[model samples]
Target: MRVLSCIVGQHNLWLVLLAAVVCVAGSWVALRLLLRATDRHGVQRSGWLFLAAVAAGSSVWCTHFIAMLAYDATAPVTFEPILTMQSLLIAIAGMGAGFWLALYNRLPPEIGGAIAGLSVAAMHYTGMAAYHVDGVIAWNMNYVVASVVLSVVIISAAVGATIRGTSRNSLLIGLGAFVGGIVSLHFTGMTAVSVTPFVTGAPIADATVFATMAVAVAGVALMVVGTGVASHLIDSEVTHENIAALRHLAMTDSLTDLPNRTGFNEYLHFELQRAEQGGRSLALIGIDLDKFKEINDLRGHEAGDEALKTIGRRLLNLSRGGEFVARIGGDEFAALKRFRNDDDLREFIQRLEEALFKPLTIEDLEITCGASLGIAIYPQDGRDAERLIGNADLAMYRAKADLTRTVCYYEPQMDEKSRERRGLAMDLRSAIEHKELELKYQVQKSVESGEVRGYEVLLRWKHPERGYIPPSEFIPIAEESGSILAIGEWVMREAAREALAWPLPHKIAVNVSPVQLMHVDLARSIHEILLETGLPPRRLEIEITESTIIADKVRSLDALRRIRALGVTVAIDDFGTGYSSLDTLRSFPFDKIKLDSSFMKEIETSQQARAIIRAVLALGKSLDIKVLAEGVETGMQLEILRSEGCHEVQGFLLGAPETFVADVVAVEERRIA
Candidate 1:
């Protein structure tokens, strides 16, 4: 009751309000600094903590002095300079220690708050001790104790609230508690003072001096607090901007500036959930660019990248309401959409196909790009993102396999085939390891004399339960599954080793897959195999199709050159089928050209086939390269090939592909005989 009477009656209302304002402003700044400090580490955290301490200490000091100026003590008073400075120092150091304990040491907030509260009480009493008056002063011990206890409790609560979190409620509670603590402590402590004037002495200072001091303190306090507030606001803005930029980078493809696989997965998941709720169908369309690798190999990756950017921009433009597009992989993209009926879906797909199929100009070269699209519908195709994406991938591969189709919808049969392929892939790995694969040798002979020249090596796989799996069936799977690399190496090594056992030095021709030729160092592997098998390089011939050479012309030519340098012959097999047969011949110094069997199948019926054969034979002869006619099964074909001056012929008419090494050796012996 006494403290309230003294506060209400003796204090100037306006000055009291000013003191409260300063306290709250300073507390707000300190709280922000502390929160920022918590987010930082090491020296940066310490810097923020030091700034918080200064703001908090200056606030308490200014509030104490202002409230003292508002109090009517009826006697002139001044502050002792050294003691006043000491009080301010005590507050700053004490607060800093408290912050360090809570933040750096990872102590509880309450403990730090208690220490801060104690510092507040200590600062108040020390400032009181700095008070000088030309009068006799008496203190009420009870009021002093009550003032200390109340201030400690209130200020502790303030620190606890502010340090707890950066939430609005917490800040408000902390600000209120801080103002209340400063106000209550000053007024309550004032109630403890009783001043008796001396009879003859004049006062040392007047009210104007104290007013000036109060103004100075308030100015300094406001300036310090304002600086802290401004720094925090700027830092917060920068932090938010950095976070947004990092998020964008995480979800975006750097090259195309499109949503990448991570972003696609998130978008798909969200769409699936929304579709479930809205009871609407969503389609996840998977698009894989056909022959994209060829583009990379031929035009260089820069042109390929430019092509992708053009495609991404087109797809982005095509996307409208309920449509989302993303580039999910290299040469792969996806689109998400919501549709009502089949007609709407088909119309959208048509637009997507048209947009993708359009020609793109990259690096001043006009190129036609095509995409194979696979769609998996919601609810029916899959219930989740992973399953849906997988189904769409299977459909995309299916469309890719059938050149006649560019768009395919997910079907159950596709899943069965995928599972079968995966099982076969696993089995193929085991087959290689267990030596379950066999090689067959087919005889190639001179068309003029029917003299044996060399034999072509062929790969054959016989499954344990399924009996024989033809090359046509499993070769594509091997290429797709990337097992072709291992298979190619195994076949090369086995053929070279078997040829080393030959009674005659007939050339052994082994076919190489493009995957193996481009992906691995084929020349080095061949050199190693020859050395390991002790077979002469002249007896080894590597047969590659024109398709392989065209896949990566530069690399393919370089590898071929290296093989030829090592004295191993290089042949372009199935030559007439590829679009670039003449170009391939000009690109590399091939030892032989194997006429595609397709031309042989049509030779008897088609005049065009015979003409093409004749042209290729003339071209090969003009270039001083031998031409071998493969699949020559009849006398008519042989006679025609001979009349055309074909250098070699291989067919079932000369001999069937022999599985046993002894049979091949016996045939060679018979031919010699």
Candidate 2:
């Protein structure tokens, strides 16, 4: 009855309310800091945990001291300075220990909360012990026990709720419970106290000093809590910004700053679904830049990167309205378009071509790039993302294969062709392993003597089901599928071995594909083949087209130089058809030049063809390189070549390509006879 009367009649209501406010504010800040601490690791987590301990200890200490000021003990009371400071240290240490215990995963988080709640009780009792009066102080044991039990239960619930989840509701519940615990503990502990006035001999502190201490404690608590909240807000903003930047980097291409393949794939699926829902048509255009590899080979990768950046900028500038563009590969790009009709699609394709084909200036050198574009319309070419992308790729390859076409719409036939090519490529690999490939020899003869000089080796494939497959049909498949390397090696070995059987030691020429010329160790392979076949290196000749040399001049010339150093001759086959034939001739020490067959077909009727042939032969003579006229089918062609002092000729007039080694040997014997 006495305790109830003291609480109802002897407390300053305004100061009690002020203490409650401080308790709630400090509890909120401490919970926020604790949650942040749990999210971190190592020393950073320890630092946050220390801040949380400081906030929590300050809150409980200030709440107790302020509540003490609110209580009217009916006597002059002053806080003992040394004991009060000791109580504050006890609060900080106890809270720190509880938080450190809570961080262990081996124990339940609620266990840590229970420990923390006990620390609050310990702090309150210690703080109450620091209170001094010019009177005797007594505590009701039952009320004291009730205060400790109720405060611990409430604080434990608060910690458990706050640590379990990060939702706003959880935080609010934890904050409210924490405030209730401190308020309950302070007021209930105050109710346990009963003071009896006595005469004092020494001067004691008055209400003024207690009031000043309460105000100072409240101010410091508020300042600490405010600083914690401010730091949390700043760190949250920085973390959000960092997450957004990382997301942008993941989706964007570093070289071009355009959407990458991953981003394009995601957007494509989204747009496809949107188009399906709206009952509208969308076009997926696949773009591949032609001669891009050549640019990378001739110029540096830096120049290649600059070219891509310029192209990306052009595409980005032109991407307006319901259009999206992305860089999907090294030199491949894709675009999405929502179009109403055929005319709209055509206009968009034209604009895209114009933008992409515009000359890109890299390192003060203007380079014009060509592009092959393919369009796959939604619902027509495909209904889903993967099918649309695949159809677009098929159409793009078709556009690339046909020299005259720059743009193509998706056609069902292209898919069939693609499947057939893939099947043929697989079969070609099997053929190489099974040794199903054979070589034929076309005779190279002296233009004036009408005498056979040597045989130029030709590859022939006789598929079991398809009968005789032409070189024009399967050679490209081999090159595109990367099976040319194996086939080229086989051809060199077989040609060198077969040439050894020739009754005469005539030079045997073997054609090397551009794919093999650039990828294989040509000189080393030749030397190994010569040693294996016991064929003289001087009798082996390697024939490569200007296209091979133009692909990567440095590597190609180096490989050719190494072959020549090994006493193996190199010839430039199909000269005058490439971009820079004279440059190719000047760049390498070629032993012979084979005039392209297209010139021979026109040499008799067209004056331009004659002049070109005359000029090439004259150039070869001046360079002291033997000139070989290919496709010499008629006497007129032979007579014309002989007049021009052509060193060699190979065509029907001399002999047709023979598959049998006996046939070539018999021809050589007949010529001698």
Q: Assess each prediction's global lDDT (C-alpha) against the native.
A: 0.86, 0.86
Write one digit per residue (lDDT tens) for candidate 2, span 250-312. Answer: 888988888999999989999898998999899999999996765676577888988898899
lDDT of 2 at 529: 89
- Model 1: how far is 136 from its true place, Å? 3.2
| Quality of model 2 by C-alpha lDDT | 0.86
Off by over 4 Å in 2: 1-14, 74-77, 105-108, 133-136, 166-170, 196-220, 276-279, 339-344, 432-435, 500-503, 514-521, 549-555, 579-583, 601-615, 631-645, 652-655
lDDT of 1: 0.86
Error of 1 at 554 (Å): 7.2
**Model 1, span 1-673: residue lDDT tens:** 8888888887777778888889889988987798789889988898999999998888888888888887777776777988888888888887887777667455777677767777878888888889876689999999898888888788777777877755779888887887787778888889999888666566545667767777888899999899899888888899999998998999999888889999989988899999999999999899999867656765789989988998998898988899999998899999998999989889889999998899988776676789899999998999999899999999998998898999999999998898898888888987887767999999999988877899999999988778779998899889988899999999988888888788889999999999998789989998998889898999999999888887778898999999999999988898888656777888788999999888988888899999999999889889999999999888898888888899999999888999978889888788678
